[model samples]
Target: MNLVSVQDLIEAGRQVSLTGSALAEQAKKGTPKQREYLYGLLVAGVEGLEGFRLFFRPFPRGSRA
Candidate 1:
């Protein structure tokens, strides 16, 4: 499993105007739409990080650079 830092989640929350534990709470108890929105934000944020780019890449066999 890929582990996401709390900092990244907080940043994603900031992008949506959420602050502090608000995002983490919503992630745990929010409606499906809210969870999905958070998921998207987290994924985008993680994918944007240089260290995580490789984990998100989908390369065919022998095609990875």
Candidate 2:
């Protein structure tokens, strides 16, 4: 597996955050199509981040109970 470096992860986070912020701005303008696209991007970004976190961190504690 290709390991992601800290810098790579940071850059990805920054890009996703910026995209989400732009999407929010578009959403505030009430453009339905833009809003939909923005929502999709936001969801993908969130899922990508969650996957990254899961890959780097240990499983949640107390889950085995």
Candidate 3:
């Protein structure tokens, strides 16, 4: 079993947050092809968030109980 440190998790969360921000920026004026690319990224981000959830204890507070 691989162990992840708190710092690693924080970095991953930051990266995902950045991805979401970029997605929003692109969505505002992106072409169809660009939007499709953003959709793929959004799906990947969701999967990443799910993976983070598994590592967390007590469900991480604010997120859906």
Candidate 4:
């Protein structure tokens, strides 16, 4: 598994926006229908983070990174 820093993710998002993400700006007149896919990903990420932060008990010190 690869670990990604928040800063890296932010930079990637900026690049995606600047480049006009395909799913978000491919149509001729308006936004693409799949634009909302980004929102779904954000929602899922938030929920998953919440679970990892709140639902699990802490591991013993020096367990896993």
Candidate 5:
């Protein structure tokens, strides 16, 4: 998938819970390519956070959302 779609998927992941649960352990999520693509999504998310902080903006900032 492209970075844009990957970024969207990353954001969607934030809405779901997988911590401290059996599913979290059992879930074998993402393919090798997808896993690699996660780095880009992470970078995008960080950049979005930086933009929000620097501009003192609200959530879901910019074209990232």
Candidate 6:
């Protein structure tokens, strides 16, 4: 499997953080459509991070080779 670099993960985390912060600010005064957009970003960010986590985590010792 191809390994993801630490820098790449850091950049992804930064992007997600910025997007989440922006979403929070917009949510304070956003319209229904804007809220939906922000929600979508939030979900995408979360799922993306989870994917990265699973990708980087070491395999279990007892798992098949």
- Clashing residue pairs in all predictions, respectively, total 0, 0, 0, 0, 0, 0
Candidate rank order under TM-score: 6, 2, 3, 5, 1, 4
> Candidates' lDDT values, in order?
0.63, 0.55, 0.55, 0.46, 0.50, 0.58
Model 5 clash number = 0
Instruction: Give the alpha carbon lDDT tens digit for every residue of 1-65 in model 5.
Output: 44334444444445343233332232236554664565455566667777777887555646563
Question: What lDDT does candidate 5 reach at residue 8?
Answer: 48
Per-residue lDDT for 1-65 in model 3, tens only? 23433333334445566554544554556665655555556557868788888777476567895
What is the Cα-based lDDT of residue 50 in candidate 4? 70
Query: Can you write out model 6's per-residue Cα lDDT over 3-59, one digit (the tens) per residue?
Result: 433333334445667544544554656665655555556558978888999888988
Instruction: Please report the candidate that would top lDDT against the real structure.
Output: 1
CA RMSD (A), model 4: 11.1
- The segments of candidate 2 whose C-alpha lies over 4 angstroms from its true place after superposition are 1-25, 58-65
Displacement of residue 17 (Cα, Å) in model 2 is 6.5
lDDT of 6 at 32: 57
User: In model 2, how large is the Cα lDDT of residue 56?
Assistant: 84
Q: Write the number of the candidate with greater lDDT, choosing between 3 and 4.
A: 3
Per-residue C-alpha lDDT of model 4 across residues 1-65, encoded as one tens digit per residue: 23433333344445334343442343223333333444445456666767777878787898994
* Residue pairs with clashing backbones, model 1: none
Query: TM-scores of all models?
Result: 0.38, 0.47, 0.43, 0.37, 0.39, 0.51
lDDT of 2 at 17: 64
In candidate 5, stretches whose alpha carbon ends up further than 4 angstroms from where it belongs are 1-28, 57-65
Off by over 4 Å in 6: 1-25, 59-65
Candidate 5's TM-score reads 0.39
Q: Please report the candidate that would top TM-score against the real structure.
A: 6
Q: lDDT score, residue 2, model 4? A: 38
RMSD of model 6 against the true structure:
12.5
